[model samples]
Target: MQAWRVHRNGEPGEVMRFEETGRPVPGEGQVLLRVRAANVNFPDALLCRGQYQVRPPLPFTPGVEICGETPDGRRVLATAALPDGGFAEYAVADASALLPAPASLDDAEAAALHIGYQTGWFGLHRRARLQEGETLLVHAAAGGVGSAAVQLGKAAGATVIGVVSGPGKARTAAALGCDLVVDRRTEDIVTAVKDLTGGRGADVVYDPVGGDAYAKSVKCVAFEGRIVIVGFASGVVPAPALNHALVKNYSVLGLHWGLYAAKDPAAVLACHDELSRLVAKGVVEPLVSERVALSGAADAVQRVADGATTGRIAVLPAGAGAAR
Candidate 1:
């Protein structure tokens, strides 16, 4: 088996090494998956740098989510348990964590769907309770997580306002069915949302990029509106103005999607069912911009960490892409 391993804490490209390794055997409560595709995530980079909250032991693989198959050919999506991840030809995952992949999505798409779509679904529908016909504001609207939020926000019947850093992303946001797209490089978000809603402000803000976006969300949130904190993709974690929230009567909700996997696993399964229905209807699709070979994993992870890529990147094991 061939796998990419990071033997030290550093940038992904600086440390990740590809080599032939022995296949791993799954222990109790685990399932050994024949890898089809692995989703590249920001956490993969964080793990490489020893910055993520849960760090695997030294000399481990980095991919966090994968779409794989059981020996009997059951296609499923699962978390690539740390120290041994989905970057290899095979990986091990907790049996209970696996969810049947939707028939509509291929391996790469299925791999991309697990974390980003689940986070958007949980953040918007579960935590914020985003109502239909309300306004949704999504930051970093072209990136993987933000793109998922944009699609889910629209599927929920919200009038979405997508904020992107540049023209290319603004176009991507518009294609994702954002009713209005705001280029933060040029347009003012507060003014745009205020104008779009006739001064009522946005009903919900699905912000994955925190720093400046969080700051502006405070100024544009409507009374009793909800701002769901999905992540701090901008690398600057903002301290929200609680006073502002009180004055405006809006709520600040923090969502950690992984907690649902632990506290209420059934809810996570339920969300996957809903997302699958949307997938069947073509309402939600994981935008996979690149499908790299297993050997190309390091560069893919690096591109994501540098904010130089749009949509999800999947690492397909040898012949996996062609076989599909």
Candidate 2:
């Protein structure tokens, strides 16, 4: 087997080395999965840099999400157990956490679906309780996590306003069903959201990029509006002023989707069922912008870390032909 390994904490591209290695052996209650398609996420970069919440021992593979085939030929989606992640020919995962991959989606798209979509579903629908006809504001709306929130918001009948950095991402967000697209690089996000909602501001804000994005969100959030914080992709975590939230009568909620796997497994399963239903209805699809071979895994992670890519990037370890 072959995998990308990190020997030291540093930038992904600098530390991730591709080399030959033995296939990982599954532990008790774990199953071996033949990697079909591994999704490259921003966390892969963080893991390489030793900044992620869960840091495995050195020389571990970086991919956290994968679509793979079980020994009995069941195709499933899973979170790769650390120390032997999905950036290789084979990886191990807890058998109980495996999810049925939607038949309608290809291996790459299925691999891309789990974490990002689940985070969006839990953030917008569960935590924020976004209502129909409400105005939803999504930051980084063209990226993997934000794209899922944009589609889910639209599916829930909310008027979505997507905020992105450039003209290219603006077009992608518009195509993803955002009623209005705001280019934060050129336009003012707070002003745009206020104008779009007739000066009332947005009813719900889904923020994956914290720091400045969170700062602006509080300014335009409506009275009693909810802001769901999913991640700090900007590499800066914001210390929010609770007084602002109190005076404005708005709520700021934090969502860490991974904790649900252990805290409430049933809810995670239920969310997957709902996401699968949406997939069947064609209401939600993983926006996979690039499908690279396993050799490109390190570069993919680096690009995601630098915020240089849009949507999801899937790495097919067995090559593109491995995915149907």
The candidate that achieves the highest TM-score relative to the unseen native structure: 2
Q: Candidate 2: where is the Cα deviation over 4 Å?
A: 319-324
lDDT string for model 1 (86-114, tens) is 99999999999999988778899998889
TM-score of 1: 0.97
TM-score for each candidate, following the candidate numbering:
0.97, 0.98
Q: Give candidate 1 misplaced runs (Cα > 4 Å).
A: 322-324
TM-score of 2: 0.98
What is the per-residue lDDT of model 2 for residues 149-251, given as tens digits with 9 covering 90 to 100? 9999999999999999999999999999999999999999999999889999999999999999999999999999999999899999999899888999999
